[model samples]
Target: MNPKNWQLSFFRREQRSLFGEILDWMLTPLLLLWPVSLALTWLVAQGLANKPFDRALIYNAQALAQLVKLSPDQQRVQFNLPQPASELLRADDADLVYYQVIGPKGEILGGDRDLPQPQEDEKLGSYEVKIRDDEMRSLEVRVAYTWVQLASDKSPVGMGPVLVQVAETREKRSVLATEIIKGVMLPQFAILPLAVLLVWLALVRGIKPLSELEERIRARKSDDLSPLDEKAVPLEVAPLVSSVNDLLGRLKDSIATQKRFLADAAHQLKTPLAGLRMQADLAQRKDASEEELKHSLKQIGRASVQATHTVNQLLSLARAEGGGAIDLQSCDMEALVSEVLHDSLPRAMDKGLDLGYDGVDTDSKRRFLKVQGNPTLLKEMIRNLVDNAIHYTPSTEERIGVITVRLLVDPYSQALAVQVEDNGPGIAAAERERIFEPFYRALGSNVDGSGLGLPIVREIAQRHGATVSVDVAHPGQTPPGACFTIRFARASNKFKTNMASGSADL
Candidate 1:
């Protein structure tokens, strides 16, 4: 596939939907936190397990040290351990306890002969160790060892050192610690899921306003362009909603303007149309005198022509206002002007006016003043300008009015300009601006016109990225008439061909 298609496909595949994205964001951290919580709980349990076990061994060792006594010879040490204390030190069931007493020289004094000695450098403090029993069962055990000074004289009665060591298997401690961890971790496990569930619920609740807004919009009619209520909207959504309302306000204004224009156009058309019908009926009356009949017929013909002109102008304006629905094609301005002038030939001849297509080149290269625009609208614009020129120019045997249509192409500016000049009474500077408005005819002009022609031309020119303006055809000269110039910007090769071919018919 091409790069654009490939990129679109990749984007589609990588698109993470809204709900999925939210769920991933909400759940991933919680999942990662679960392992961290477990590790922390294990560390705490291990730390706590050592405390009680160390205390038990310390108590045993201290009791056993008290039972130690020196013999008279002072060379031997004796242990007078009590039966209750001995029983307390004995292993219950399969659990094992070991105790030992040693001389300063590291000789074993009491308890099991097989019991291991504490390391010589081992501090007089409690610690935990793992060891094997007579049954070969591995056990985690705690040991406490301490040295005592014996009372002695003349080689000392009990001055030499004696060590007391006590140890017990950790099966009971293991069970107790396991129970403690279960008590602590089980509730947390339950609460973890509950916490996740609560978080998901809260996210859904927080997003409820957006869903309500969607529903409200979906329920609205297509034509409804009214602003939405913003008072109760969430702060995060208010800005977007306000922008939408602003867009709706603009659209409402556009729709209202179009409706008013349509109403005005109807009103303008109805009045003349009614008069034309009435005049036609009067002309058809059988009993009318010849003079009366002739006058009625002339009035009917004038009204009919006026109505036709008005209708044509209205159609041109409508076409220009239809926006981008019209296709823009390449056209030759010179050829288009020639065709328009040819079409106006009979009208000019009837008035004995001098009509001509000036500056038209026969060579295709020089003749092709190409432009990109809707050809039909382009022709209508030219026809209107030329027609307006023809209607305003005076016709007399002494000096005939001349209407010239010219096309000029400027390659450096990429522009095509069409000019229609007439030798007639020119409009005043102030009236020139108002002449392009619909139904706005100049005060002294005797020519019949709908006044929509110039406006339609202006609209068509604008739609094609062109500018239309009126100026003097012959400045500082007597009998100077109005010159209408349309300058189209940005002519391209493709546009040239389309417009040229389309305007061939015009």
Candidate 2:
């Protein structure tokens, strides 16, 4: 194999499962959103962990603010805390706490001297606690601070405001946050795997029907062309199954056509083959007279001719049906009819028939009058129509057989039509369509024919996008003549509209 084809074949062999595709679509979003959910939960836990601790820090700062009292003479601000209140600072073993107080004149009053003052940008409310985060003693801590207004200004040591601040390390907040994270995230860790498992199981259940359908198709015998059960499948799959059923129905029709063609072919060939065998045996008889021998030879020749004609007709119909190499070339309808008439002259004359052409002048050769089609098939189609007319039309002492091959083009629409008319036993309207089937002869007709001529004509006409119709040529006469018309619609678009409007006589 060539490298390009080999590469293509190799690439096409790669397969993907529908179940796997569905699972990936379902679970990919879930898996991707899981980490997002975790980050949001952790952030929420941290905010929640800080709430109670911050409130406690605010209360301690307020308590220390109350302790800054005015002296008896309203001369100074002082800070004091009960000894029992001091132990509350170190109550929690996991975290260290610190507090500080500063006089307005920058004097250290009470508590740890290392506790930093609030930043200048801090909006400290009067005796209302405000909190911030800071580093104190080389450890991260939460701090709450408030400013107190001293009530004394008359004395020399008058103070403007006192600062009361409380600071605590973040060890307790970290533990609390860890606990919150555990409470919220632990369940999800377990649920995530279960969610994936449930998703996997759901996909398996969802696609189980396809698997069952495959098994049903596989279990059937090779020749079984029965349709899949559309009702049993899902609504989404019913349309696909319906399409498959339609294909199967067409296949069945095609197979039946082939079988019928074979049976009819065998039946049609049997008579001439048997005639040839009998004629040969008779000619070989030892007591056969000279006249008898001559007649046998004649019979043998007639049988062989009949056999050859039947086989050729059958092959022609088969080739037309098979659509073999129909390369289209433009040909004049009038010229083609003239050619078929010339070829069928001998046969028509033998029957004393007036086989003639009624069409446009050959010298004119108008461009619009010409048609596009396979020339060989077009001639074959015309020949069949002309032959049928000559074969069916009979001449007698009273009247001569008149067979006319007429070519017509609509003057306004330019649509082309070819008609073969004969004063023969015309076909009834009911049997006209049936006669187009292979080996289907008209009812009550004694003519010896392969019954494939009209069928071949119809097939070839169809290949060129034309329609064939058979109707009585002369109605209400002694023998209503048959007229076969082939209409080529591509002469112009207006032709279709004209034909529909019944404006064209053809």
Largest lDDT belongs to which candidate?
A: 2
TM-score of 1: 0.61
lDDT of 2 by residue, 1-506 (tens): 89999889988956888888888888899989988988998888878989999999998888888888987777667677888889977688888899999888989989889887877777455797887899987999899998887655575434577888899999988889889989988999899899999998888888788888889999999778889999988898889889999988877766765676677679888999999999999999999999999999999999999999998887777667752457888887767777788889999899899887776554333555698888888999999988888887889979988988777676656668887888888888899899998788889888888899999999999989999977777767979888887888755656544333323343
TM-score computed on alpha carbons, candidate 2: 0.77
lDDT of 1: 0.75
lDDT of 2 at 232: 88
Taking all chains together, each candidate's TM-score versus the true structure is 0.61, 0.77
Global lDDT for candidate 2? 0.82
Q: How close to the true structure is residue 69 of candidate 1, measured as C-alpha lDDT? A: 80
Q: Residue 172, candidate 2: how far off, in angstroms?
A: 2.4
